[model samples]
Target: MMFVIFISFTLSSITIINGVHFRGGMITWEPVSSVTNASPNITLLIHQRYAWSRSHIPCTQTNIFNRDLIGDYSFNPIVCLSSSTQCNSADYNSQRISSDVYCTDINLILGISSSSRSQSLSLRNNTKLVLAFKGNDSWLSLTYGSPAGEGWSLPVFIDLTLRPGIGINHSPTSTMPLRINIPIGILTSIEIPMSDNNVNDVIKCRWAKSAGTINGLSVDECAGACHSYTLPSTVQLRTFTKNRCQLNVTLPYVGYYIVALQIEDFSSNSSTIALSSVPLQFVLYGFDSYNTRTTCMTPPRITNMSPFPTSNGGNISVTVNGQYYGVIVAQTGCVNDTETYIANFITKSPSAMKTSSFPYAQNNTSQYSMELQWTPTIDQLGSTLTFCAIAIDVNDYSSDPFCVNFIVGPEITTTTDTTSTVTVTTTVTTSTLMIMTTSTTSTVVATTTATTSISTTETTTITTSQVVTAITSALSSDDGRILALGLGLGLPLILLISLLA
Candidate 1:
């Protein structure tokens, strides 16, 4: 369906600033061609999606100055809807910027106003060539840079008056799109976005059965209340508000349904002044399936595992950042089994591996983070371990697995001492080495040496190869292996590391 707006040229010259008026978009063109053959399409790069106005509110001046706005002009003489409640309307509001902030939110204007070219365009160099049209007034402000009679002439500026046309923020002759899935037997409130036409005009909207294929279902037959229904009469009183004109409905069935809606503006006398018909449309959805494989249940994801290269042999705290990690869902009396969750850890051959979860650590619908504690045994030295976590919901559905890697080892440093006498000093930084294995075979490498000096005047290097061989042989004995295993068994330790860095 096509709707035409008639522009009238007989409106007053005063600016209307306190209320919503007409809503529309914009267009662009070249006013004057440059001598260098630069295409006059300065704003051709701007997409039409960026150049939209609802209730006379425009986008930010930065969007305009950057040539991101269409029509190349600002819509002034407009009031901003800054209230938290008024600015959240899905139709007139983008929900991207704060309405309370000036130039950060769009303005909604209607009716008509007459202003000079300078007033309409803000008279700035960036806005110099813009041509703005709204209500009954239109103006063109331009600057000519080409050589005239002799040298560069003064910049040319022109302003003109034009007829005012009525504009709708939303398409008046088309059906709005609605698509959503809702779980059955659950009380839910859905917000339907609609446009607020004018303050003097009250909008009345209603939904009726539409005959056609909608959401892959026909409205010719009723699928119980779940398959089809209409908004309660009181919904009009509960849904419409200043800057937010919408419809509210409670759907209590599980099936596809076709719904048609119509909105009309009424004057204070209760007479219809304008009409908008939403084309027939369908909203498709089904009852929520509590299976783990259902697409609605997003799997858990790991955002970050901090403190990479974790040091061994110390108290270490591990922080895991993840989404849909695990949430505690309060159970209802229903037997659907959709509210239970269990979080577990998996690792390969961990030594002295102990686990503890933070009670009520974190919970959200699908976003969560958990803190875990563990200490590696001496036997796990120099070994890198990856810990994988998975969450299971009440319906036996398991989320995707997330893992983090950590290396177990202590910080090592070396030092040497030199004296007047010729001496060679060797040091084994740590005296104890613990090797852990399920097998019976064990290998040992040890260096035992004392600080000794040669009496000869000339520099002499003494070799302790015999002493090292003796130590290695001694450590290989059964008694030596028993001692090493005893030292390896110790309390769980934690490595303090920051994963965010």
Candidate 2:
């Protein structure tokens, strides 16, 4: 006996029809399309089972339906479009089902129970197909399998691609303040933007006093306080997580300052300091002062020291003269009070020497003098000494060091000696009228010495000798006295003696 059976499935606007036939304890099915406009490329899978189970068995049990049922009657219920030839290979032969054959491998089914058998059958949007069951069973006792299979069938899986997203929420170039005024000791903040999807990303910034140019503004035009007078100093900017950055700065002087800010992400480790990129150049105004001068704080200066080149002698006294002996300012406790100024003599060469603090008097409103003593040790003799004197105000504000050069020399010692010496000589000649001559000679020597000691002691001895020749010569007391007087009074003689001695 033969009977006709109808199976209908509706998904969205697509519907599938199958005709089931039973003959001689065997089942067969044919698919039909209800809609004519369905695309042949579109695939469909169907899974069906009884809504209620008599035994209350879970719909997810994998073992309830066996692949091998009865003799050559294969239980593999998967199906797919005839175009997918692999669908025809599924049978009791037990070759692990290929996603190519099973439509379920591609995730095409909906609403399946555990006991249901799986079949992969691809149908055009509104196509029909005939399927057959291997064994004879009441339609009420029959359960359907997932059109594709239990899980994501095989090869193609829904893939979601993710892309990196990072952007600056606030444009540093457009939104950043180009100019700002910060008072002395006052803290100021500037905001940086971090607009990105990554919540875990971090942002960082570093600042330099000289930012060549950012956007169209020259960084040189934005000079203030420290940046105005010296090489650009770099400061780091910090932020934790909020994607917002704040730069806190304290202005030191009343002048224009230009700073270049560099931004980077912690994760990317990239910075915007490249020439192609533009960073904000901030023009910050500092505190207002009565005497508006573009100068950094000056340390004490030692202008002059008396003597100009001091000697590094034992216990030598030195005098330092200079100005800015702690100029009174708003920072100091006592305004214009010179007494609060402290002058210290520092020895730079000999780093081990302690700083010498001395009192300084304002010789005039613009200059000052301070007296200090330096004693040189034996080792320091002949060694050049370098010294600087710095004045510090009560507020700990210090002036530039006034440096002095010193020459070390040995102490002077004097010794005196007086000496007297006399010499006598005689020669005689007898003349006979151009015929005969006779000659005689005699000599005498005397020495005297006297010594005077001062810081150094010395002993001196003197000796004299002389030779005389004439027509007639003899020793004379008068000559001796004359010689003595001449020897003592002669300027050339003393000079000669001094040179010879």
Q: Which prediction has the highest lDDT against the true structure? A: 2
TM per candidate comes to 0.23, 0.22
Deviation in Å, model 2, residue 32 alpha carbon:
99
In candidate 1, what are the lDDT values of residues 1-501, reduced to their tens digit?
Answer: 212121101011222343222121211111111111222111111101111123243433243222222221333222212333432321113312110111211212211111111011111111111111222221111111111111100001111111124222211211122223444344444444343333444555444332422223233211111112322232332325332434344434454322334333344335443322222222323344443333334333333443332222222332222111222121112223235333332111122222233213243433333444344444335444444443433332333344444566653444543222222122222344444322222333222232321121223222343334433343344335444433332111111113323
| Segments in model 1 whose C-alpha atoms lie over 4 Å from true places | 1-177, 197-200, 208-253, 289-501
lDDT of 2 by residue, 71-96 (tens): 11122332332223423332212222
Clashes of each: 25, 36
Candidate 1 accuracy as lDDT: 0.27
Which ten-residue region of model 2 has the weakest summed lDDT? 151-160
Positional deviation of residue 226's Cα in model 1 after best superposition, in angstroms? 14
